[model samples]
Target: MLDMLTRWYQRRFSDPHAVSLVAILLGGFLTIYFFGNLIAPLLVAIVLAYLLEWPVMQLTRLGLPRTLSVMGVLLIFAGLMVMAIFGLVPTIWHQVGNLIADVPNMFNGLQNYVSSLPERYPDFVQPHQVSTFMITLREKVLGMGESVVKGSLASLVSLATLAVYLILVPLLVFFLLKDKEEMLEMLSGLLPKNRRLTSKVGAEMNQQISNYIRGKVTEIFIVGIVSYITFAVMDLRYAVLLGVLVGFSVLIPYIGAAAVTLPVAMVGLFQWGISPEFWWLLVAYGIIQALDGNVLVPILFSEAVNLHPVAIIVAVLVFGGMWGFWGVFFAIPLATLVKAVWNALPATEPPPEEQVEE
Candidate 1:
């Protein structure tokens, strides 16, 4: 067993490039694990730079200087962000406050409905069972309320951090975008000279991350706008809030859509219980999801995501546990990075079994 392990290790690590690749991967993982919070602004800037790089490139192609291109793109993006902050955010926050205010009434209605379930389905649901369920649900709701209160208190500090980010992120993004090549050259100089494998992986991830970010941002806006329009047309309350939820839901693959359905259905049911309008709203939502999965996703992410459903879910759970929302958001790409590294690594195949096995 020791000999077999040694052979496996030697076969895999014999190449200098493979060793370099492993070191680079380990270093990156360690850095993120240890200092991710400390360097968050820089990381955010890097992500935004990736998102804006394409447009900068296009502008540069049009004979504009790169510095000027970066300025133009940064200003446009910042303006849109400012607009969202002042215009869209307040409405969503208002809806959120309204939802919180309505939660007690909603909970009472739910309890009343559950209490009726025993009579409606006497054989399947007993009074005790309904009582147990309601007790558990009430506890959960109260716990959620407590959590919300804690989160609200915590958000005061977060707002101050956000203010710092608002100032620092764009400056970092501007320099990162404008001095892209110079920064790359400097970073490359720091890496070991034998970095062929690292370079290969980096190139693949650079394109993968760029495509994924662009496709995702586009998906969010398209889904959000369509959902908002549908909800508004149906006179659904908190259309903007629900729309934004539906939009961001795309970030988590299978889990997100399934999770968001409850809120949409609950909102609709409470507003228009068992009515044709509620049914139509669900149908429209289903169609939108179907089209997004079958059409928009394929068109937008033709070459971006190539992972299996199981792999994707595992990535979401694992990386999300490690890094929270950003992990979930970049789960697919991170999984792809793992896959790429696995494929790129040198491996040793076991010897074939002898014919005597038959």
Candidate 2:
């Protein structure tokens, strides 16, 4: 049976191809089946490993042992996690409580706005009523309401999974940090090469991943600081809460930070009215993003990583479908790793490194 199996496989695809196909299908199926329970935490672990590797490498250069270095990384990580939870939980909970308390006020505002809209257009029907000419419109609005409720429920489920991720992240991160080198070595051995090529690719990918991760975290911290200072100075309500959210969202590529600011600013405008405070948020965020784009990002993330904007969108779409927010959050990092692997292929590599463009 073994001889026959070998003959059939050897006559068809290469051994590597056969093994890789099996690995891909099996791993993919398992990931799909256990995504909520397992895959997410594993991805977080990988990303955390990326973030910590630089400090670990730096520690080794400073003459610390690998084990000690890894421990230091874990310590810093734990300290930050504790500090963030302490700082953020109260602010977020406070903001959330305020929102809950203001629900009636918000509904009043919505009702007032809708009333005003009809007056601005006299031909417009009452927002909540149905007349001979507006029955279809009323039905459509009701359907819209149902869709909104469904969307809200979906969002709640996603949020609950995020809570689960918070629980899993640290545990996974600890193990990943401790077993980083061993994992890399074991995975590298499975690569179909004379070992040297695999080792080089592995090392290059590690460096790229580590650099990207550290740079991104530093960027987030800087953005957060800039936002907090601005919001505090501007005297916006829930400024700290919104600022921290903006800072973290900014870690996502392109649209993340800017996307959240619109709604946040609108809330400020609505609540605070069109005063200096109302407009200050827009100006502050605009300036912060400008500075980040022109100075901070270029200085900090010099290598650029060469990911296409189109690639980023596709990744967000694909992974967002599979894993929702997490897929969106970690899409860029996952895409980066996938890109590195794709680029490493002999058929995919541009002639040679030296021959490639500067």
Candidate 3:
């Protein structure tokens, strides 16, 4: 067993590049595991810098200096951030508060409906079963309410952290964008002299991640705006809240849409019951989702990472379990990084078969 293990190590870790890659990956995982929260601002800055790089390059191509180009992009980003904070945040917060305030009423209505379920379908649902379900549901709802309250209190306590992120992220993004080439050069200098495989993998990951993040941001804005207009036209309550939910739902691909649908349907049901207005609202929502999935996604992500559906889902599950929301958000890109590295690594050729009389 010892000899076999030694042979395996010698065969696999023989290449210097392979050994270096393993060390780098282990080091990276350890760093992220240990200081992930502390370095979140830097990670966010890196993502923002990557997203803004294209526009900055376009400006540079149009005869602007790189510094001026980065400044212009940063200014636009800052203005947008300010607008979101001032214009959107307060409205969303109000809607969220309203939603929370109405939750108890919603639960009461749900309980009443569940209570009547047995009468409506006596053969299908017994009163005792309904009672049991209602009890369980009530407990779950109470638990959810308590969790929300706790989360709100926690958020208040984390205001300082949030402020740090707001300040530090922009500053880091600015410096990163301004010193992009120099930074790349410095990082590259740290790597082995013969780093063709590493460079290839890095280039591929950079392209895929940039396209994905930029395209996703655009998709969210487009979907949110469209959903908001549709909901407002239909006189739906919590239109902005639903719109934002629908917008961000695009982040998790298959899961988000399905999860968000319950709330949208519930709100519509309570608002319009079995009316044509409710049906029309649902139809419009469906159309928007269809257009987003079938049309908008293809257009925006024409050059996006081509991940298999199963692979994407697995990545989401694994990363989400590991890092929660950010993990879910970065799932595809992380998966793509894995794919790129796998492709970059040199494959071992099978040993040649020795033939005698055959």
Any residue pairs clashing in model 1, and if so which? none
* Best prediction by lDDT: 1
**Model 3, span 71-121: residue lDDT tens:** 999999899889898999899999988888888887888888888888999
- How do the predictions measure up, each by TM-score? 0.94, 0.70, 0.91
TM-score of 3: 0.91
Local distance difference test, each candidate: 0.90, 0.69, 0.85
Candidates 1 and 2, the one with greater lDDT: 1
Measured by TM-score, the strongest candidate is 1
Task: Give per-model CA RMSD.
Answer: 3.3, 8.8, 2.8
lDDT of 1 by residue, 160-245 (tens): 99999989998999999988889999999999988898899999988989999999999999999999999999999999999999
In the range 310-351, model 2's lDDT, one tens digit per residue, is: 887788888777777666765676677566644443432223
| Steric collisions counted per model | 0, 0, 0
Pick out the ten consecutive residues of candidate 2 with the lowest summed lDDT.
344-353
